[model samples]
Target: MTARHVLLLTAAAYASDPDGPWVDGGLVLRAAARAGLGPSALDAAERAGLERSPDGRLRLPGRRAVYEAAHPARRRAAHRLLAEAALGERLRPAGLLHRALAAPYPDSALGTELAAAARLPGPSHGERATALAHAAGLAADPEVRAGRFVAAADQARLAGRPHRARELLGRIDELTPTDAVRGAAALVRGLLALRDGPMADARASLLLAARLCPGERALDARLAAAEAAWALGDALAYQEAVAGQLSGAATARAFGLGMAAALDDRYAAGRVTLRRVVADAAGAGAPDALLRAGAAALVAGDVEAACRLGSRALAAARALDARPELPRALELLAYGELRAGRHARARTHAEEGLRAARAAGQRNVLAHQHAILALVASLDSDADTVARHAAAAQDIAARHGLVQAATLAQWALARADLARGRAAEAAARLGPLVRPGPRQGHFAVRMLAVPCFVEAAVSAGDLGAARAAVAEFNVWADRGYDPQAGALLARCQALLSAGDPVRADARFTEALARHERAGGDFERARTAELHGEWLRRARRPARARVLLRDALVAFERCGASVWAVRTAAELRATGDAPSHPEAPGRLSELTPQQLRIAHCVADGATNREVASRLSVSPRTVDHHLRNVFAQLGVRSRVELARLVDRAEATRAL
Candidate 1:
């Protein structure tokens, strides 16, 4: 056989697989043999018009022209021959493609195989997706086409193509689909709406999906509806979504029910159920389950457990390509770190979570991340950042009825007001949020904000209001959910008991004692500052100096610059100027990511180890480390370690 015959045969083989840009090299070889051409002619054809990619796939240049030029009979022969060859080679997608093309009309047999392969979870997702798309177009029956399109819509959604997913879902309207197939389509639509906004629509679609789907899928749809209800702060909807579903041992279902309990303020029941979620999810493979369980742990006030679960979820989500869960996992870590009083670490996680939420089109998670960032900025007295993030969060929350995000953003704004010493403004701002009213904040957050409300009220000289707020705060503190709640409650009591010197001193002393057992340095510092102020007013300058100085140092160490400044001024008022005021340290100048990398490297973690621990690429670790070194003016890891040691020693003082 001449090289001319090889080119013609290879072009016909390429034409047989016209949907793909190129044909498999093995297909070309099979076609050549069927054409009575020796294997040696293939090399000559390669030197002719046939081209080979670096990946070893075969293509014929001007293949479209070659295909159009070919006789109809020859193309049919090539399709039959190529289909048989693909089957023999066990190329399922290729054989299905060729066999479907060889049919005169839509082929149901080929479409079934293609649809099954496309829906199967595997590494070759793109190939499966392409084959199924072709199969759906050529399917003979309307129901079969609708079913295939349903799977295709799911594949598009999972692949992060929202528009294409919606387009595929639209195709279902033109055909008759079984309830199961229609239900599956609804589930995908609900998930997309759940990620992207309008919580009411998401909840409606999810509830519909739950009713229409099979048993297992119904459970999934219900759990997802529970999520939308949680975001909307619709407790009744949350209960309805998870009703009669708490008996199961599945980690996800238990987590959803636990969250429902949290929304109901049943801390004991929620914590007990969430403990099971934590245990079960530790061994569960689904990243979404781990994320849901982590969220339950967060709501149960188990900050350390939540952080641990969030880390595992983040790593697993990335490994499993679960992009939608990535932001939620990061949110758990950020909020946990914030509660743990690691402001810089919280900032780092919040910053990354915000980006992930935006990329994944999770508007509600995006708003929540913004609120986290806003709170972080409020701590540092960065009013612009606080306002910017809070506004961004509130705007989205208003449009989508995101109650949690709105509550968090408002709390951040009020915290900024209190930090800046606008006590009256802060008190007014927090009144509706903490009290029972039409504009009241979320239940859990409203309770958490009570301490701040009490402080603001006391500072504004509204002792009656402060006392009433403390009475409510006392109830939450007695529950023992938040470790810092007890300490904060004592401080509030001291603020209200200033008229009785002995009672005021006792409450202040109790607050300081409780602070030792709590985790947040910021809260501890607030108590110390308040106690010092009381002592100074009571003509005890020496004791006032000690507490004030301690509060000042703690504030600076935790990056609460405004609080540090206020504490320093209080110390100075006692006629004792602070010797170690806020100083710019190498650690303080670095961004959150850079600072974390510096600390890890200084602790003797290699770049790869840091990357693994943070669930980022080693190259990302290396890049951040270089920026850390440049920012800190450090030449080596040894220098960074020395700097970190000095910073720790300074903070310890």
Candidate 2:
């Protein structure tokens, strides 16, 4: 069928029945637009008030007019015209009649006609007979009601209402003789078993359904069997069972398979398949599909894509008044922003999502949101706040058996401890997280673990262990899974510990670059402190003092009190402490050169451009900037920029 025809039919279906078989109207519109539908068609639809609802359900004011205009008979002709317009199909009365017969209807003749019109080559003849019998209220034919119950159960399951599906299936089973309907009962029982987490029973029941029914009735039964096999850790069996099942073509089933692959660490395969599902969903404008796609993007490290998809999902959910899915979309958006280094945006969305989840009594969502907040707090160097949020997340996860979330919370707690300089405590706290190897998405946890181990090794002066940890981290980094600024910073520290000043300086510079790229001002400040210490050890005391001072100022500005104090102590030891004791707290104490450099950097001008604007040679600008860096004790130009990005961000609070 033409894309336009598909979209029109989809729209008509949604308009005729808001709660219908097809759940995503937005996807259909997108597909139609992509297929080169003129703006006039969309504008006409819009004028008809079809696009007002975000969920894509039509809301036409003149329903009678719409019904008269798009009657089934007329629709059949329109479909023929559309096929000719888009597919170059030749008109045939038999074809038109066949298509018309396939259309869904309340009566047997219409249903039969539509089926014949659509050329649906299935044992639907039996289904049609059963439907006719049931509609005639034939008392002797028990299979008629059984067919109706099965159809209703299938619809409920497709709509994500598993409980309703189970209820209907139960009624169907009770109404039929046990021996006669054993296969149908087994299929329904299998689906219910899967939902209730009894994979073994689900697998057995579905196996029986596949054996007894062996045809159309076994489609869902086989898929359920595969899912149960997957859940039971029988990967080969699951893959074999779902390889050619009808349900395997479904988006939800594909998404489930992708998730299973991801859990198995087959990221490349998972990413490709998930992205396909996402693309299809996006094309169809499916909110749930968009939400799933956003999650997949996150797993693939496409934070920007995740953010966009997640926002779209949130809007779709809100339009549909789907309160349950709103927080999920919002949380995904918040995490995407956080990963993309949009801290203020992340914080705002996270807070909103948290409030919504809490209000809805969604403890699992609340816990995940809390964990995200804790990560943000850690980035801001709010150790106490991070600890509190992490503790709360841990408690919630533990109470609810959220093992994956609990692991992340534990990692966050370790981060808080490390921020407070309690390396030993952090290492101890993170031990379980590392040993368990994660039940889901272990990359983030593994990233955090390496830093904790390195921190403990460094604090105890175990250079060998530190080196080993850095090597292990390098493996992950090489594979492009590095999760934090600390990984690069740790590498720099290891280089410094190994007494390779040249490479250590180079690594430190790289770490500074990474921090700047990530917009991690706090880490940038810490990098500057390390660089300053390196310079001091190399007897470049003059330069060391300059970077150290900048680092201290930036740290204090970012609310990193511990690092600020440490940088200040380093400055004093180098005999290059600020001339004014209160200078760190007072912005005006900064020299003109420092202020000028800060302002230019914050404006995102390159150093050479800053030089041109300030009427200085690039070298002179670099020298002065280096002096500014030393005087302010900052690491890179990016950190300087972040320090001066906003008054509040840089202010000593």
Candidate 3:
């Protein structure tokens, strides 16, 4: 075998002696002998100082820098071996134990051990780490210097300075070079790339690391590469990278699994994984795992848990003062609040999140944050705010290919149009989104917007489109959504039957009941407005009057101007003035239906004649006229005529 192979075998054997000095050259010669090196090679190793001859016998170097720069497992083995020979022994006991036991047993053993112990060096980790650190300063050998650089890079990475870690790792080849050292450099570079981004290039570095690493170091590189694959959204790479991690930190691994599931839109699996990630004392986690967990909770419809986790994540981010992570934490927290119907608080969080994202130059997060703000504005019926933010968000999302954000912005803009009475324009904008497609996996997002889309369709007289939207939504509801989403689904169904007056009334009742079960005041108010409009169109003036008034109150309370104004108009059409609303009993106060009956009586038509013309029974017509006469304080048809004449004469005057 070549000298390098013998030296490698020697290092492996040195690392394998679980009970021996962690890094002893004398033990290495024995280990080389174990690898089949002959006495002559051992002598050569001794003369070459690889098996350092301190006195008459070969021994390991007293310093800890000897094997400290090797691959991770090897470095670990070296440190562990040093630790086993604790207190930084000046001399190794492995060789002496043998030499003493070889002599006259009891008599020579104690003396040999005593001499060995007397010559022992400091073997504590602090002492060895200190010695190894100083040795790097004095290291003139390129390989030795490279090892020291690797050691420093390890510390830098652990300390969270990716830039400094990169700087140290970059010098491996210039200092002490090996394919293994180069692999070590590559692994650190890949990890740094992941933590700080431009994640596109991380895969290449991690691939290089996995390829060049000699042993278990490949496992570390491959696992990190999987995470890089997830960040880049590369499915094939994620599969390969994930397949390599047979074992590791369970929580960290679960976090990775959760992220992969979330990317694939497998919410059930993702939620399960997230639960594992945050279970108090479970697996180890990265700094951002909490935020990821919170996001998963939000998507799974666990709003309360999502909000709690988000708060915790933001607090953790603040504690660390990690500017890059703050925006995502805030964004997640805002989403939770939005789901919980805390609109004002959600707006505040989203605005702050947007500012942080902009300052951090996080374009992806900035796009999502802007979408969030637009959605909040849309809820408040603030058309101007919705238009501005939705436009900005859509532009960035389109450029970045952030399909989710782009679609959400479209939803906000379309809803704004619907609120403003541009139903045709709203339906036109939302048509493509309501249908089933590749984007349909974003069930909740689409589900939330479908009600608005259905409204637009009904108002635009696109019954077919409205029906299709309701059908598509039914599929989602069947698969299951949260109760709030179920409420929205019911609301959409009610809107679909807008032309069928009886069915619309029944469905509107069902929908409002569902909303009450789910508890979103905004949705309840919006549904009320729709039901009132339907009732007014059906000529159920008494029912319409009550619903419209209640709806107006709700809309105003929720700050929904457009719906409030529309409800007011409907109230006026129900024969109640918007401002005064026809208090108790007043002259000339009559429903459209009642006024028609009054005119029929004023024309001197018999009740039978009036019933024939008005498509009602004579008794019904007589009864309506009696009520109209009572309202005007007139007892008979001729008296009603006199009252009508007086109203006409007053207008003429």
- Report lDDT (CA) for all predictions: 0.77, 0.58, 0.62
TM-score of each: 0.76, 0.53, 0.56
Model 1 stretches with alpha carbons more than 4 Å out: 1-106, 124-131, 245-249, 578-653
Query: Highest TM-score: which candidate?
Result: 1
| Poorest 10 consecutive residues by lDDT, candidate 2 | 85-94
How well is each residue in 553-609 modelled by candidate 2, as lDDT tens digits?
777666555456456556656765233232333335577876786677555444556
Task: List the candidates ranked by lDDT, beginning with the highest.
Answer: 1, 3, 2
Q: After superposition, how far is residue 47 of candidate 2 from its true place, in Å?
A: 39
Residues 1-653, model 1: lDDT tens digits: 36766666566655333434676787767766776778679888877778878876787778768666767776666666677777442466666666776677776777777666555444233345456667788787888788778777776666555666788789889787888887898899999888776889899988998989977788889988988887887777888898885433466677777777765668678778888887777687777777777777777677788888889888988887766678888988898898888899999999999888887677888898998899888877345678899999999999988888898888898888887678898899888888877888876678888888888998899988888778888887776668788888888888898889999899989988998987689899989998998899999999999898789779878888756656655665677743443333758888888888877766545566678788898889989988887877776664565566567657766
lDDT by residue (405-426, candidate 3, tens digit) is 7777888888777765779998
Selected candidate, larger TM-score, 1 vs 2: 1
| Residue 352 local lDDT, model 1 | 97
Query: What RMSD does each model have against the real structure?
Result: 10.0, 14.3, 22.2
Error of 1 at 247 (Å): 8.2
